[model samples]
Target: MKQSLTAMALCLTVWLSIPVAFAGPPHGGNPGRGGGGFFDSTNEYRDAVSLQDLQERRRQREERGFERLKQLKWQTGYTMPQHYRSDRYKVDYNYYQLPRPKHGQQWYKVNNDYLLIDDDNTIIQVH
Candidate 1:
């Protein structure tokens, strides 16, 4: 009975120690002992500034594109540029609270304006 108890105690000790052995070093085992994660250095600040500058440049480029679109004087009788005729620019008239287009006519959204174009790519109207 004593031998059996000794064996059980040894088994329990080994079982408990197994978890501690595999637990690994505390605090992620960082040799430098630095606990701060990700944004923990001066480089992080530089990265943030560069990211903001990139965003600003993107905004400026988009504004320039919109300005270019606005510069085109869309007359009623003139044909619209070919690029604007793509399906991507097409919009539903009812969704924009505009009047339904006549046959062979479709509505297109360019920047903030709505343009109605005919099948021949002529600018029927601009709103």
Candidate 2:
């Protein structure tokens, strides 16, 4: 009876070890998702995403922003055109404070055109 119990325990141990052994990094291959279970495919994918393509994409975005500034629209109720003017909105010691306009008037500019927007998002003046 003791020999039978020992054999049963040994069988259970071997059964549990089978799955655990296969679950680890298979053979000499990496367990990472980027690799094909054995080979590193990261460099291949990284090279595919060329630097020239990324630079060109950034240049296009910059050009688009410059174009938007050049062509200021008569759009009212707009939250804000450019995020770079955030300094003007905030009271920072480093940035120059914009002079206050008439009561209840906030000046917003896209490019060279200055738009006077009121508190209620209404266009008061466009120059």
Candidate 3:
């Protein structure tokens, strides 16, 4: 009887502690809503856009990534930030921006690393 009681207590403890060991996302909603999510970061109103459209945008960006990066007017609206906390956009270049996110595949810098992000805010490629 004592052994059975101990086993039950142990099982209960493990069940309760499982959440702490592998906690879910903070928001507890869709895990891929913000940050490095499966959707677009610029898209403030996720309700308006359909999933198919978003997927299509990502595909287009991946296909035309090279052309878009080459045509970027780097000297125009882009400028090196005064301070950066993370090396998310590291690159060899001195100038860095917090990703002027656009509608298609865009090139960015994150700590000596060149990143190519798709419309879905997915890192398609990196250099």
Candidate 4:
């Protein structure tokens, strides 16, 4: 019975020591592994500032675009911007209650308004 108790005690001691023997570095495992030891506050702050700066720049760009659109006065006989001539801006005349464009002309949407432009990029009509 004493020998059996000694063997059981030895087994328990070995089982407990196994974890310590295979333990990671004293400062904990690699930070990338999320072992939780060291943290760089500066990096975190820089990342946050970078994200905020990107958002601010995006907002400013959108504001500038809106301002530019507002400043434009789509008058007849004036040529429309080349960007508005792309197929991406094309709209259906029937859906928007607009008149059918003649041959060589297409209906395009610029912001909230619709414009009828000819192949020459001329602003035929604005609605």
> TM per model?
0.46, 0.41, 0.21, 0.49
Indicate whether candidate 1 or candidate 3 has the larger lDDT: 1
Query: What ranges in model 4 sit over 4 Å off?
Result: 1-40, 82-89, 95-97
Measured by TM-score, how close is model 3 to the native structure?
0.21
Clashes of 1: 0
Clashes of each: 0, 0, 12, 0
Q: What's model 3's lDDT at 111?
A: 46
Tens-digit per-residue lDDT, 1-127, candidate 1: 9999999999999999998888744445443555543445655787899999999999999889768867887779988887688999999988899999999999999867788999999988999
Of the two candidates 3 and 4, the one with more favorable lDDT, higher being better, is: 4
Model 4: pairs clashing at backbone N, Cα or C within 3 Å: none
Q: Tell me the lDDT of candidate 1.
A: 0.84
Best by TM-score: 4
lDDT for 124 in candidate 2 is: 58
Q: Looking at candidate 3, what is the lDDT of residue 54? A: 83
Tens-place lDDT per residue, model 4, 1-127, is 9999999999999999999999875366466665543554555687799999999999999889878976888888888876566779999999989999899999988877788888889889989
Poorly placed runs, candidate 1 (over 4 Å):
1-67
Question: On residues 7-58, what C-alpha lDDT tens digit does candidate 3 reach at each position?
Answer: 9999999999988999655445454655533354545455356676888899
How high is the CA lDDT of each candidate model?
0.84, 0.62, 0.56, 0.84
